[model samples]
Target: MTAAPDARSALRAATTPDHERVDAAFGAFDLTTREGYAAFLLGQAHAFLPIEAAIVAADPRDLLPDWPARRRGERLREDLSALGFPAPPTGDWAPFRHRADILGAIYVLEGSRLGGRMLARSVPADLPRSFIDTSDSVRWRYLIEVLDKLLVTDDQHTLAIDAARRAFALFEAGALRQKRTKAFG
Candidate 1:
């Protein structure tokens, strides 16, 4: 028989590589100026809006009943508007129709909640930060407790991990695009 899936450890291991890529890409962005911050928010908007729609469209209710509360696209949109930038024109994602894949996508968003406080602190004093708030550790712990109980097969686990990688790739691509594009005033 196949080993029982360990969602927490599997997800942790799956996302770490892409996580490092995202961190490195983010580090390259100069966040000190209004334009730089706008670009950053725009990149986030590109990634989050599409990924959020995919997770919602996949109807993650079964796996994540609290999925609605977990979305951060609105926050990204708020940051975009505050920075006088329009939303990204694209809202497409890689094929993530399966519940496992979609939940994997959602996991990236949920996990990002952990870094909001530090990211919020990164903005300069004069920057807009309506969307940058502290991570809700209570909610994170609750999600983790739920995830720990899931019993996916190794194949399903692989789908979830692949989705996470795709999610990160989407974000990294958007960030790179932002670095090359014109910033909103």
Candidate 2:
């Protein structure tokens, strides 16, 4: 018999489609240009601010002690302001009702940090990059460890996977909305 997948592996496998869609949507931006980069940040702020607020409302400190430091909304806002744009209006998100749900959302947010590092290289050096440039591999490792320990049941796994998919969908929708608006153009 095959050994069961770990929480991280399971979540990753279940959400790969959603992840790909979000990546494709956001990847359309030309980060090398200031307008493209600002639009990217605006879309990110639109989705992330509300999602982060919902996560905070769930009070996941017990699961993620360093949650405060992990937040990037303020950094995104700062970057937007530097580009002469105000913060985009936040949208509503369904509340995270369980620890597993919160874990799933955190998975998406932290996972994006990994991609952000790569995208950061594409961003012009003259632009503010506090949101994407911040690196914390150690925190990521800690989150993985937490997931392995806390997510031990089928129900827990399902909740996490569903939450993760929702998180990805939010980002995907946000990117499409910003792309259509051409708000920064």
Q: Best candidate per lDDT, number?
A: 2
Model 1: which ten-residue window has the lowest total lDDT? Answer: 143-152
Q: What C-alpha lDDT do the candidate models reach, one value each?
A: 0.75, 0.90
Off by over 4 Å in 2: 183-185
What are the TM-scores, per candidate, against the unseen true structure? 0.88, 0.96
Q: How accurate is candidate 2 locally (lDDT)?
A: 0.90
Candidate 1 residue lDDT tens string, 163-182: 88888898888888887775
Clashing pairs in 1: none
Best by TM-score: 2
**lDDT for 169 (candidate 2):** 90
In angstroms, how far off is 95's CA in candidate 2? 1.2
Please give the range of 10 consecutive residues that has the lowest summed lDDT in model 2: 176-185
